[model samples]
Target: MPPEDEPKVEIKLCSENDLVLLNKAIPEPGYHERRFASQQDGKASYLLAWQNGVPVGHLLIKWEGSGPQVNKYLPDTPELNAIGVWPPKNRSKGIGGQLIEKAEGMAKEKGFKQVALAVEIDNSRAKELYEKLGYMDWGHGEYIDEWVEKGDDGEETQHKDPCYYLVKNLE
Candidate 1:
């Protein structure tokens, strides 16, 4: 059902070298290493999408909630964090959806009946895509999305955004 010229996409768990490769391609600096450490610690899983042997997209599945609301409400639900397709040219073309589908399957395999993720309030494109894949607004109010950004000066700055959670049942 795909065009003949469409590049085949393969999804796999991120390895240490693959983490380095993806960092080189996307220049996320320490982000990948941090996620990789989480993966090593059994706290998360980092998945990468490859096109023609090049890393094109990534998704992180946290085994437990990282926020107060999520911890209070969806305590056992694994969270899908930081799902993205890179290079600007890879937008659409179903790559992002494929990564999500893979994440859903993984969650199901792990015996989880539900999965959750948060979307920036303004990210309608991603919200629409998630809805298409059966995710629904979690109805809980917004929470502050938090992360750290390391600067060229080797200093880390905390960043926050307003986001709300969404959930999907795997049953």
Candidate 2:
């Protein structure tokens, strides 16, 4: 059970209908576009945690074929990526932990034996959260994270970042 200050939330896979709602609720730019594209291609699963009909957090589970690191460490495992909590004020209330748990459940349902993810070397806060949720630093390796977004003028912009890999056995 959550503490008195933490609000209760329901975590579930985002449906096609939920995509529209997520786009409106999430303040981060390009989040909706990326997740929507993944969903349309059936390459990823987006899970959202709702509290009082509002989205409090979200996580993405990308299939093995989509993440290079997952293919290398645990080829059959899904990669839990792009996790975030909205409103900044809603953080540290167990919403992030709940999102991770929901991602693990989805991976298990898909027959994956493990789950993997990458964290920026300097992101101590996120690293700590993953560790607390049972994810461990399996090894040290660099990954080139890339994404493309469209500008208001219809031009596309690409971004990249380097990160370290982590994994967790679901069994």
Candidate 3:
């Protein structure tokens, strides 16, 4: 049991209605919408962590790997992407760990031998968490991470993040 004041967190597969609530809570423009579409199309799985019936965090599992290195090497491993907990105040509360554990379970259920993720070179905190969870550096060096962010003005901006890959084998 958690402390009385700690919010009870529930993890679930992202639902269509959940997107509306998430958008209202996080307001990331078209981010959730696009991810939801990919989930519907069987290209990915978007998991949402809800606290008090509101989305506080999310993790996206791409059925196929991303980046030249991931594609070239771990082609069959699902890649966990864009994991985060919002409100800034929610950071360092184990929400991210919960999301990652759930994703690993889902991948195991799907018979994947391994799961992988990328951590930005500068994000020492995230890297430490991944390491504590048994994710090891892939030792393939770093690569440029690419993503698109949609603005409130309805325009898309491409981002390039320098990151290294990590991998974990499922039991």
Give the range of the ten consecutive residues with the poorest summed lDDT in model 1. 1-10
lDDT of 2 by residue, 1-171 (tens): 355766798998777777667767886566666786786788998888999888878888888543564466557877788889998989888898888988898788888888888788788899888887788876755776676768767788898877777788888
Number of the candidate with higher lDDT, 2 or 3: 3
List model 1 lDDT by residue over 64-108, tens digit each.
866675788777799999899999898878888889899999999
Per-residue alpha-carbon lDDT of candidate 3 for residues 1-171, written as tens digits (9 for 90 to 100): 234545678999998989789999888778898889999999999999999889999999998877566778777899999899998899778888889999999999999999999999999989999999999988788868888777888788899999978999897
TM-score of each: 0.93, 0.86, 0.92
At residue 128, give the lDDT of candidate 3: 93
| Candidate 1 ranges beyond 4 A from true positions | 1-6
**True lDDT of residue 71, candidate 1:** 80
Q: After superposition, how far is residue 89 of candidate 3 from its true place, in Å?
A: 1.3
Task: lDDT for model 2, please.
Answer: 0.79
Ranked by lDDT from best down, the candidates are: 3, 1, 2
Q: What TM-score does candidate 1 reach?
A: 0.93
